[model samples]
Target: MGVKKTVFKTFKFILKNRLLFFLILLILLGALSYYYSENYYLHEEDPSSENFLLNYPDGHVVSLEGWVVDVYPGGFKLYIYHHGKDTIFDVRSNTNVSVGDNVFVKGNLDDEKIITAKKVVLKQYWMYIFLLARSALAILIVIILLLRYWKFHLENWEIVRRK
Candidate 1:
């Protein structure tokens, strides 16, 4: 009987403070998400980690996408930034690429950490900016439409359909 009364009281408290309960739930989920993301790239056994890749023998084929840091006569230096284990891949390719350009390279990693690229694909920076602009416009339109159809009732702390 005592356990039943305590359980009932706890349930009543949760119902009375439903907003606080949900806020705490959301925060807990967010914290867990952050923790998982931060550790995901740093795992020792993960193939993407620098330590894991360093153990691989020479002539291993790999695919990488990163920004071109430098452009020289025969090839360019590709800067792959991943979770502070940043690496600059010395890529030897015939593909015409400029500094600050995003490129995807399928290549072989030599013993000296150089990459002999078999294929190089250039990703234009302008296209990315255009995509972001379009997304922002679409999001703005959606927000406007939502506001037109819904009204927030401060008295009840709820969103009600506009009549």
Candidate 2:
């Protein structure tokens, strides 16, 4: 009888603290997801993993996506983001690019750890900023439309469709 009473009290407390209960549930779910998530990138020694450039054999065709950290007359130095560390590689491409540009290169890996790019795609810094601005504007528009069509019911403690 005492155990049942304590369980009932605990249940009542949880029901009264809905926000705290939901927050705890969310944290538990996130922990479970992280625990079960794949960590292919974490294994840098694996040849199949894309996180390390050295995993690929020299003269092998490879495709890499990274940012240009320095630009030279012939090419630029690429900095690949791999698990909080930078994997820098030299790229030789004729495509005009600049430092801070996001680039995708498909090329052969040379013995000197250089990529002789067969094809190069560049995304300028201004284009990335414009993309962020457009995304924020779209989100703002969505929130405005949602509030216009719905309202919170204080008595019920929930959002209801406005008529």
Candidate 3:
């Protein structure tokens, strides 16, 4: 048999086994969703600041606990100990904190020693909708492919038996 025909025959055989095909499809979809969700959560962006730290290349999320250094009208600057490096964060002045108060700030670490605050909490909510949409589309495509394979196998089987 030619290579094309041999490949098609093998594909037919695999599709005829419905349980095996579905099981493989499920595993693949699950793996894709896991990967997407992990990456989505790991790279969330904070939208509170005009200068989003996550927008910077190689920027990372960090938590800094330190005393407020200077409070300005627009924003306040915080001197924080971040990963053994002293860093400054331009925080919104409206934030409920005093200059001498020790506070914990959670945001992205920028190259210019700035942290753009997304939220005070450790968890971020920006990427949740994106991750959900991606995962749903992936699952839908897998299901459609599985259904198409089943239909193709049924049609081919009927033709072979008619001979």
lDDT of each: 0.79, 0.79, 0.60
Off by over 4 Å in 3: 1-58, 81-87, 121-163
Residue 144 accuracy (lDDT) in model 1: 100
Worst 10 residues of 1 by lDDT: 44-53
Put down candidate 1 lDDT per residue, 3-111, tens digits, no spaces: 9999999888877897878987899999999998778755533234353345654676666778999989899998887657777878998888888888888777775
For all predicted structures, in order, the TM-scores are: 0.62, 0.63, 0.33
> Could you say which candidate leads in TM-score?
2
Candidate 2 structure, TM-score to reference: 0.63
Candidate that would win on lDDT: 2
* Of 2 and 3, the candidate ranking higher by lDDT: 2
Local distance difference test, candidate 3: 0.60
Superposed Cα deviation of residue 108, candidate 2 (Å): 1.5
